[model samples]
Target chain A: MNLISEPGAGALILRVQEERIDAAVAIQFKDRLRELTAGGEGPVILDLSQVTFVDSSGLGAIVGAMKLLAPSRPLELAAMTPNVARVFRLTRMDSVFRIHATAPETALHVRAAG
Target chain B: MCAPPDDAALMPAMAPADCSALRGGDDCFRRNFRAEPLAVRDALRAAVARFARRMGPDDAGTLELTLAEVLNNVVEHAYAGLGAGPIDLTLCHAGGRLHCRIEDHGHPMPRLAAMGRAMPATDVACTDLAEGGWGWALVRSLTEGLAYRREGDRNLLTFEFRPACR
Candidate 1:
């Protein structure tokens, strides 16, 4: 249930470090995303290359994340695995978010900040 | 469980054996677990392993997602008030389609007749976009021959999926 945050030049990126985001962790995922995106001004890009699967509950949590930032900060998706992308595409959330094949060119900010 | 199933996770889930020690024509898997998200996760994992050798990556992914939604529905909705109940999952891969039946002895799934008929209106404002209610839609969109029935005290939901031929 941990997400690695990378500082981006024009956006904020949070990478899910888990394999599956199913019913087991959907609530926590939503809460964590809210916590990370609370004060960020730019679009929050979710790096999902490591996410192997996402069920409907996970999908809902993602939508919740986007709605939480509504009208101001956008929650975008990037680097979706085949299964994870399919869920978003099937639910038509792909059209809602700015999806990137791979997370944009953000230098992987190391933990030297804190 | 309404009917006992030798959990695929526990036993040597190679081939299902019968009274005469005769194997069935198709590979079938049956697992019984507590109707909880974590148990559903474990069951989905076992089911994938059972059929992964015969399935491609895409089909495996589809089946896992579909089953996860169905099984999670049982956990989140079916047994909402009844704590944790037992969920019986039976999956048989035959005729190039994976058949799934999940049984749970919880509250009757309300509005059973109108399930998955329409996709939740995803075309909405960001604030109005639904956070939930997409489970049945995703289940219906990804699978075929979806049906649900409450037999006395148990809810039996059956569905099928045709895996794209590789």
Candidate 2:
């Protein structure tokens, strides 16, 4: 699991560079998120444009990532594909986290206008 | 043609017969793989590829995700502490629904609690929200006809999916 971190304005954008984030890579994802955001002090927006699939374990890993940066920092999700969106809806986790329909910068504008 | 990863476990021998049933090259897929993450992933990719041309995108995605949930559970629970064991998966589409049967020589579920449980509570503090126990919900919501049985040393789980397109 390759995660690229881009420093946004007062926020951090973490991009998942894998096609699938299921049981095969959930632990790696959690460990990598911890490593990338160590000592970071801002809301982290996860860019899931490249992720085509995320199973229950992957969703748990994402939630774990959020709890890891709790109280001070937040982990947000962006650019959810249809399949990814379905998992969130079924688990009711979509309402728990802030979701974005577009990429990082584009979602910012969409949120502002809508 | 290039074979999928972990081709040794896939039994695509019936490919020609399966193709004769429908317009595309899918009606059944069978594989016997070790209950491990990478092996499960390979089986899923192969199954999706075999059925992709017959179903719509959402149905295809549904199949992959639901199968992942079921297969993952089998690995984490049934095969726990017993090392990776063999899992048999057979998928067939007929009468406008996809039928799935998975078998393994692992622990039998005590009561088939997966389909009986409700979704975990979502109305909670951010810090208190549950992270796991969500797979069963997805599995139940995505498929139907959930049944489980243990025959001798093998455990059989049967389920069905009604394609939204049908």
Candidate 3:
């Protein structure tokens, strides 16, 4: 469950290093994402290009990470693989989160787009 | 040295049979796993990959997602407090349809009345998104024949997927 974090201009780009996010690492994924974004001041762009699959538990974990920073920081997803994106589309979570083609450089893009 | 006779000439000739006739019969797969989340995930990945090789990737993805939701539910709710237990999974494919039956002794199926089956509102703001309730909805949407029954101490859930429908 290695996550590479890079602080961009006004956003934190957290790239998940795993190929699959399923029941096995759902809890660990949420906990680690929470820790990484706890002190960040701006929007968070979650890079999921490496994640090829996501199950229901994994979807829940992503939503849980968002709730952990509700009413303040926002969590956006980017570069989801086709299989992973299908899960979001099937569950209609694509409507709930701001999904992007790729990780944006700054929080300004997120704010401007939102 | 003398050359060996041709293999095809050495054997008796046989007529070709219908491929559909062979595919029409049930092809069954069964496995039992410890009611642990990681084990469940690994088993599902392997099984789904095998299925994909046989039934194409699209149908396999649907099956994988639905089964993941069901098995994860079993691990999270059924075997929650109880120690490791055996979870039985059986799959049969025939006539362009796949049937899956899962059995567990840990807990009876939860009452639908208690746990609502409604799809979470997708129109809500990002800050107010609900995550946990979407599993069942996706299962119902992707599967054709879904049935659940608790017989004695066993919880049996059966679902069917018609790949052609997708």
After superposition on all C-alphas, the RMSD of every candidate to the true structure, in Å, is: 10.9, 10.7, 15.4
Which 10-residue window in model 3 chain B sums to the lowest lDDT? Answer: B1-10
Candidate 1 per-residue C-alpha lDDT over B29-49 given as tens digits, one digit per residue, 9 for 90 to 100: 999999988999999999987
Can you tell me which runs of candidate 1 are displaced by over 4 Å? A109-114, B1-25
For each candidate in the order shown, give its overall lDDT on alpha carbons: 0.78, 0.81, 0.75
Candidate 3 lDDT by residue in tens digits, B49-104: 65666655556677888888888888888887987688898888877678889999
Chain B TM-score against the true chain B, candidate 3: 0.79
Interface RMSD of each: 15.2, 14.5, 21.3
Tens-digit lDDT string for candidate 2 (A1-114): 899888877788888989999999999999999999998898888999789899999999998888888868877788888788878777777767776666566343333455
Best of the two (1, 3) by lDDT: 1
Q: Give candidate 2 misplaced runs (Cα > 4 Å).
A: A105-114, B1-26
DockQ of each: 0.26, 0.22, 0.16
Clashes of 1: 0
Better of 2 and 3 by lDDT: 2
Report the candidate with higher DockQ, 2 versus 3. Answer: 2
Relative to the true interface, what fraction of contacts does candidate 3 keep? 0.38
Q: What is the lDDT of residue B36 in candidate 2?
A: 100
lDDT head-to-head 1 vs 2, winner: 2
lDDT measured at residue B26 in model 2 versus the true structure, 0 to 100: 36
How high is the TM-score of chain A in each model? 0.89, 0.90, 0.88
How is the predicted docking of candidate 1 categorized under the CAPRI scheme? acceptable
- What CAPRI grade goes to candidate 3? incorrect
